[model samples]
Target: MITVLVIGIGTGSPDQLTTEAVAALNRTNLFLVPDKGADKHDLATLRRELCETLIDHDRYRFVEVPDPDRGPDAERATDAYRAAVAEWHAERARRYAATIRDQLGSDGTVGFLVLGDPALYDSTIRIAESIRDDGRLDLAIEVIPGISSLSLLAARHKITLNRIGQPVHVTTGRRLPEEYRPELGDVAVMLDGSLQCKQLLPKHGDLTIYWGAQLGLPDEVLISGRLGDVIDEIEAARNAARAQRGWVLDIYLLRP
Candidate 1:
């Protein structure tokens, strides 16, 4: 049986990797890296660099797998999204099974390195679930948590996530409402491409925002101020960065 370790390496920096995560990588015999086409080559390269820099073991083998793109389809229901993702994950599980059987021949420890904490908006855990659904993965699975972009973003700006005893809401850009419930203390929004911040400014009060793009990366962009004062700047910056890199990942925190 193959033992699988779903380890988080944090955002692009090796310094962000926890000692336990590094140790898990070194202990594994096989390392799995996912390639999401050219736009994401840097992501795969960063993982590769982490292995090269941190792991001293030469016996550890690396495997690169191409990910399937789930076509553009609206998922209004949770089951709809789950079904679509399950199909995508089924294909991925087949690849993983084939790789383990053909490449490693079983009885070895394998690591699937995730960009951030596996539980937070990452599909690695779902893929692992797919593997289990098929009864193909009979391995002992373990998870090693890493620093998340939220943690990094908050730390970079030197701000706590919430006000005293206040409830903080974490949400994605896609599902965010044009108007938010004013009772939430702080909103840490992620996976946002819609510029939801702009829509919320009309309802703004003492709202201040600390937003960061490409958190923890060299080309990271950060901005903060009254939501009304900086909404346009954030939009323009996001567009420019997207055009510059051909891709962009950003997150923001809203507090009052």
Candidate 2:
């Protein structure tokens, strides 16, 4: 049987890795690093650097598996989007199964270093479950949680996620409108490629946003103010980040 550990290494900092995550890193016989190509080569390069710095021994090896594209239509949240995501996940599962079968010993451990906690807006967990349920390999899966961008976003802003006894609501950029009621407390928005907050400013005049991009990385940027006041600033920052780094991963807390 092969045991796979889905370890979260946090957004972009080595310090974000938990002690257990680091220990799991050293235990794996093989590591699967996904290559999304040159535009995101910085991502793959960072993973390789992480192994070089953290792994105490050279007994292990890492392979760069070319990641399958979920494509353009999958970017939206809709029935077609769901279908595209399902197909993309299926492709990923096939690649993962082939990698494990070809490279791992029956009893060896494989590690997947996720960017954030697997339970939050990440697909590695589902893909691993798919492989296990297929019954083609004797596999066991484990998860070691790491600091999520949401957590770090809160930390960087130095604000609690909730107001008083109210709870924090989490939703994606596309679903922001559905979850827009401020009475529900603070809403943490993620996976927003478009500046969806602009739409809320007209009606929700009191909306405030605490936003950050590339949280733990050197390119980190933070903004906080009334939505109407800072939306343009956030957009400018996001655009500048994408222009310079060719990519930007951002999250924000909306207080309504």
Candidate 3:
């Protein structure tokens, strides 16, 4: 049996690693790093940097795991998009299973570092569980949680995720229109590049938005104001930032 530690490393920064997370990194002798193509090369670099900075021993080795493409993040309908994502996860499971069998021994311990908490928007845990369910390898999985981008978003902006006693809603950009209304209190939107935010401005102009991109990195950007007042500015900044950096991971809070 192998132990798979799905560690949450937080947004692209070494300081975000919890004491437990750091310990987990050092405990594992092999690290599986995800390669998200040229556009996301920086992401892989960040992961490498974390291992280099935290792990004191030279005994650990890393293997690059290529990401299976799930196609463009286009504006697809819910069912179509979900089906596409399911297929993508299946392919990833196949690759992961192959890697585990080829690289890890029955007694081996390997680690997969995910950005933010594994329970958040990340799919690493799901992939690992799927691999285990396949019966190709006996995998004992452990999840180490870290500061999520959502948590940092609120921290950077100095606001709580929810309004006084009001509920906080978690949603994706695609479902924002259907799931959120100005009366919903505080809504945290992820997997949205502030692109889907445009659709909401037409009806909820008075709503305020607290947005941040590259939350923990040096290129971090924050914009907050009335939805109608700053929507254009945010859109332009997001596009320009993504163009310059080749990638951006952002989260935002929409408040009524």
RMSD after Cα superposition, model 2: 1.4
- Write the residue-wise lDDT of candidate 1 on 1-256 in tens digits: 7888999887858888999998998998988887788876777788888899999978888888888777654444667766887788788888887787777776889899887688898888777767766787676788999898888889989998987889889988766674477787799998887677777766783579898887788888999998898888989999988887777888889887
Clashing pairs in 3: none
Off by over 4 Å in 3: 73-75
Regarding lDDT, does 1 or 3 come out ahead? 3
Residue runs of model 2 more than 4 Å from their true location after superposition: 74-77
TM-score attained by model 2: 0.96
- Count of backbone collisions within predicted model 3: 0
Q: What is the Cα-based lDDT of residue 177 in candidate 1?
A: 70
Q: Clashing pairs in model 2?
A: none
Q: Rank order by TM-score, top first? A: 3, 2, 1
Better of 2 and 3 by lDDT: 2
Q: Give the per-residue lDDT digits (tens) of candidate 3, residues 64-134.
A: 88989888656677788999999999888898788777887666888999999999888889889898998
**How much lDDT does candidate 1 score?**
0.82
lDDT of each: 0.82, 0.88, 0.86
Of models 1 and 2, which has the larger lDDT? Answer: 2
Best by lDDT: 2
| Model 3 lDDT-worst window of ten | 193-202
